[model samples]
Target: MQDPIDAVLIGAGQRGANDYGPYALRYPDRLRFVAVAEPIQERRTRFAHLHKIPLEEQYESWEDLLSTPQKARGALICTQDQMHVGPSVTALQRGYDVLLEKPIATTPEDCVQVIDTAAETGRQLHIGHVLRFTRHFQKLHQVLRSGILGEVINVDHRENVSFWHMVHSYVRGAWANQADSSPMILAKCCHDFDLLLWILDRKCKHLSSIGQLVHFRPENAPSGAPARCLDGCPISDTCPYFAPFVYLDLLPLWRDVADTSTGLVKFAAKTQLRAPGLVRAVSKVVPFLRQMSDYRGWPRSVLALEPTSDAILEALQNGPYGRCVYFCGNDVVDHQVVLMQFEGGMSVSLTMHGHSHLEGRSTRIEGTRASLNAFVGFRGSWIELNEHRSDRSFRYDTTGEVRGAHGGGDVELMTAFVKSLQDGSSQHSLTIARQALQSHLLAFAAEEARLGKRVVDMEEYSERYLS
Candidate 1:
């Protein structure tokens, strides 16, 4: 367009693709999809072809893309949880500014390292805290900054993750295991931490909380259940969560393809249904997932860890939450709440309840002067605020229009990453890893609190966790 090119998107996932938006097509003169690095071959290849990038530009891994290109300026790293660090740090070292996804790292150390690397390299590393960038939170931030609500003293937010989503991401999904992926807090609530910090404009000084797998365990599993929810399972009839909404009920929604005319000619209109992981890529690339959403009872395959005698793990795999002893290996928590005190004089109290609502939703912010609320329902949601003003009150809620991953964050986050590159900025400008690390650290502390039934010290919390 203007020069050789502007930047490259890394994941080609929900966030990466949506960020491409009109910028790639409408302003072809201003931007281009120089290359893409997605793990999914079908996705990466299709993305490359769609963007018109030659086979040479399409990369299987971020490593190959940055290493070969040599002159790249911006990068969007959108892999899964455990994979955040290496690519981000390496990208910075390679001189490509980064736009990383959130929960920076499952641990604090990774977050710190990513942040420190960026500072040392002088490259941008914008974390995908897309909510802050959206009209919903942005308007709320505007209201808070506008002083209509007065100085924010405290905030309480509860992100209500749906029961089905809980099973997918936390119980049986890729992020079900904390050690392998991220603690429930970090995986789910990093945004809450960032947001509380953002709205308060303060640093978290002391933080503590608790959480556990209250539901979706063997204890919660039906009285007479089988290991799997498939055919021949002892009880698929009465079990509510037998066929998972994400995997089965919504299979048509998430996997259904339309026939414009009927044959291959019409397939282009709804090809996502044809491909294996195309929906997941579209989940990564397109804006609709954020804007749209779910069905019910999608089957989740369960895996039981035998070595541990935690009793908790045992029940999670073979008890009520597990459907029947022939379990649907659900090994994650259904609820968690964390308490945070900021060095900047801001305090936050937050919770994430997966089985609480139909859709993953959130709402909170209670302060001495004013309070705030934000929520997303199966149908839709809104963000609201009311100040303790003497004369009148202030308000705002812009939730519906925004669409895509984690409440439309993936798209907005990707957009930020791409624009930062076009603007020649660094990741430090968006969501930094250090703060992400701190948030994650708080997550572990919360888990400890949940288990031990006590408050945790912030300083003491650090020695135990690192991204």
Candidate 2:
């Protein structure tokens, strides 16, 4: 067995604590989190407790962590989009490799700066484009590269962000506005662009795009609706995106029961659902009980500052999460389409929609000899292949319990990062800063094209902005 690599976390928020930090717990032999820097006291304490880090190593901010000597072999930076460059550059210069979360940074100039800093400091900088590590996409990559799909000509990809998720994250949640975070494309669909570039292995030559925040605005707010869900304006029952209902009712089901393993649902039923209040509540409402089956962790986290209806209502009425979806200050688009012409006469089109029945990506690739249709999702996913001349068809089922967050990509990425650090090799590393910069540039170009209502020549855009 290999020795565990010591790591430090920069932000102990949702991604740092819940996503990557759990990996250290799950595989203690592979990675260990020795220190963490977060501004929030409770979150810092919780992360330290989870990782068993000593008190002296916990700091209130990334600056404090940097002020001290470097303590870990690597840094996992899960800070906000705009916050990536500073801590990442500092960590690299101070002699630690970094695993930065996606979008690298919010702007094209900042993205370029981070990449340059990594190069100048001579440190490994890996971006969190985890989709590259998924088994489903890995299979797709293998099949596409096998020459079975000869002379790949065109690709069509769609990312359906789901209506509920769109409202939750973009309309009322953390990533609600462009000026505050980033354009919807870079913030949400950078992974899609990265994946397309990876599979196609061709540089995009031209870009065009169109999108707008057409749905969530003051004009679209339901008449008589309150600014906050719990304020008693009216129409709570009819509004699917109502904050209280989604958090109190649907989020629990989505978190605990939806698309999870049967064993986990069984375990939740035995341990979580058996709480006296939950049982008593479910017993009286049989159909609702059957539908939800008692999973309360996420809803409780978002709604209840404490575990009670009063607390939940208090938080909802007071915080940004409870704002009316259409009345909030969100300006990010609900839908977007990017058209691309890559080198070698291949064309690609991507559609990113926030209003859909489900959350996942669907892709179609066409080649001279064969074509493929694939669905990558939580419930069920498959890839269909057809050969033009042979009249033969093949189907591959690529769905199962994804071992970690982002369809098992998180664990796989951590494993690869540790191995690369240990072995001094870059073979398994995906989306290092330089490679990620290209996709970020493409996103910037697409946005410019959309805003300017003109086709963007990649060479000129790259020269003017990214260069």
Candidate 3:
């Protein structure tokens, strides 16, 4: 067996610690993390403890970590959206191959700079468009290549951002404002753009987009609702987005039960309705209740480093995670859609909205001989095909046990990166910087089209920004 590749991590946030860090733990023979740089003391310390890195190897900033000579064969850049370009360019220049988290940078110029740096330095650069490594998407690509769907004509894709997830990540969380992060389409749906470009195997020729912050504004807040849900909001009993209901999972059991009703069942429902505080207290006494309440994993883990019951409650009471979704000053769109014209006369439409009940992605691809419909969700994933002139139909259950986030793509992407590093080859990489730039460009162009209210020609957009 090949020796494990040594890598350094530049950020220890959610994706860094939960998604990619666990990969090394699971497959120690393939990869080993030698060092980490995280600004947050708690996160940096926790990540070091988990990975067993020595005190000398952990740094408080990416600049401090990368300022020295290259410490490892590769660097995993999982910094925030705006912090990506600097670490990536510096890492490549310092003789380290890079696996950068997606939406490469907030701007086209910065993205192109990373690509140019990698090329100029003669080092490998892999963008974290993990959807390409997923089993469901890989199977979908196979079915398309088999001509089972014949010549594809058009495609419709939907990124269903579950309501809780929208409020947690985009509404009140890190990506709520475009000025702080990239646009919603780029930050959230760049994976979708990369998927479309990869599966369709064509460059988008022209595109236009339309969307806005239609909901989740102060005007949409219920009458008498306060800025914070914990501030004795009037609609707590009925609001699905009440902070406790979302974070503590304390919504009423019977959705139709009236809060004023008098009965054993109704009483139990009402008790459950007000159990967030009780649950938080009891979780401290009974340790297992923490897992039952989902305080150890994502949506909750993103809120705190420790993610203890008390920690979560404290975050809710004062942190961004606890803000009322409607009252939070989130400027990213609650919903958006993009339309693209690809080569070979194929058209595609991507709709991304934050009002879904479940988090998942669904797509419908129409071809000459058959139509294919597919869905990949947190609960399960499936793909179905139907013939045009006949009654023949086929179904595939693609829901293999998901190891980590992104439909098991995270693990698979890490595996690919490990293999590439082991062999000193880019052939194992799914998408390099230059190819991944296409999807980023598509996102930038779509944002321009949405804001400018005009169709953007790919050639013109590329020359104006990329050239």
Candidate 4:
């Protein structure tokens, strides 16, 4: 068997945990997650203990890891939407190849810095646009490239990011603070941006977009919204965010180490429901439930939170829209339409909506020669799709296990990154900084076009801003 590669993971947040936690536990032979760097001691310590990593290897911050170097062969930057650039740029310059999570960076300028550094350092910087590595999309990419689609000309893409997932990411999660993390455009749609570029095999020449914070904010916060999700909140029944089921139900899995003598693993195996360890850890982030499991203390918790003020804020927490904060917090639009002109006049129209019922992705394409229709269900996602000609329509679908977002793209991404690093192959790393930056720019251009209510030229953008 080939020796495992030693790796250091940066950031121990939800995204990082999702990616590194599994690989480190199961694939110790193929890839060893040796160390991690995170400022939050709570998250970092929990991550270290969960993985049983050595004490010396765990650091309170990335600078500590950088200062106290060991045998790390690669690094994964899984920080929030805003954190992708700085650490990654540093890691690349220091000779460590990077697996940077998507959006490249929150903005175009940050993307440029990371990309420019990679060229100078000669280290690979792999962006985590995992969809490209996914089996479903890979098949679709093959079909499109195989001339089966017959000259792809036009495209449409939609995402049904779930209400809960939306809240976690956009409402209370790391993505809530757009100014700190990113604009709504880069926070959610960079994957789509990169994916479209990857599928269409073309560059964007123009883009126009519009969106609004239609829901989820202070005005929408239930009359009894507590400061946090856990514990007593008068609005327990009234507010969608008050439920502890999603956070508490998975308690064991989130934290609380298994009691081996009790056959906890075996018991959990039978039910396969709770992961004690994980529950314990995640619960800490919102420990109000433990403090006040009953709703008696709810009023106090409610007192802690300030009233929802913004139109977007009102829409996210408690509004006419149930838990769907499509209209919530700040000014990010719940629905957005980006009309783009790709290189060679191949147009791409992507409508990113806060569509609650559907998740995953849906795509449509039409050329002078042929057409295609695709569906990637959010929950029972098997990636169903069909193709069309002047006369015929072909359909396909896969009924698979209940998987997370991006259509199982996370695993596909990690495996490809591991292989590329393991073999010293250059076939990957094709998601160059310039290419990634273009996606960021397109979002910026779309916003500009929307704000100005006019078509924006890519040439003018590149020359004026990027130049």
> Which prediction has the highest lDDT against the true structure?
3
Lowest lDDT sum, 10 consecutive residues, model 1, at 291-300
In order, what lDDT does every prediction score? 0.61, 0.80, 0.84, 0.63
Each candidate: RMSD: 9.4, 4.1, 5.5, 9.1
Question: Which stretches in model 3 have alpha-carbon errors above 4 Å?
Answer: 250-295, 427-431
170-288, model 2: which lDDT tens digit per residue? 89877888888889899888888888888787899998999988998999888888888888858987787887766655543353334433454444444333463564466466553
Tens-digit lDDT track of model 1 for 120-231: 9888877767667666666666666766555566776778775656665676566777667877777777777766656666666666666676666667666655565543
Q: How many backbone clashes does candidate 2 have?
A: 0
TM-score, one value per model: 0.74, 0.90, 0.90, 0.76
Model 3 C-alpha lDDT per residue in residues 1-467, reported as the tens digit of each score: 88889999999998888899999998889889999999999899989999999999999999999998878999999999999989999999999989999989999999889888887887888899888888899989888889888899999999988787788888888999999999999998889988888788888999999999988888888888888889999988888788777766634222223232235534444444566466556668866545444447777787777777788889989998788888788899989899999999899999999988767799999999999999987635789999988969999877645545777889888888887877786543534567788888999999999999999999889888666
- Pitting candidate 2 against candidate 4, the one with the higher lDDT is 2
Model 2 misplaced stretches (Cα beyond 4 Å): 251-312, 426-431, 465-467
What's the lDDT of the predicted structure labeled candidate 3?
0.84
Q: In angstroms, how far off is 94's CA in candidate 2?
A: 0.3
Each candidate: how many clashes? 55, 0, 0, 44
Give the range where candidate 2 is weakest over 10 consecutive residues by summed lDDT.
290-299
Summarize candidate 4's per-residue lDDT along 1-467 as a digit string, tens digits.
77887788899876676545676676677777789888878678877887777888888877778666445779888887676777888787677888888778766677778877877777777887766666567667776787766667788887656554555556655566668677667767777787787777788888777776667656766555455543245655544343343232322221221221124333432233444344335446756323212221211222122222232234334432223232334455556788888888888888776646434577888766567777655322233334444466566553223233345676666766788888885434744545767777787777778778888988898777567
Task: Name the lDDT value of residue 44 in candidate 2.
Answer: 92
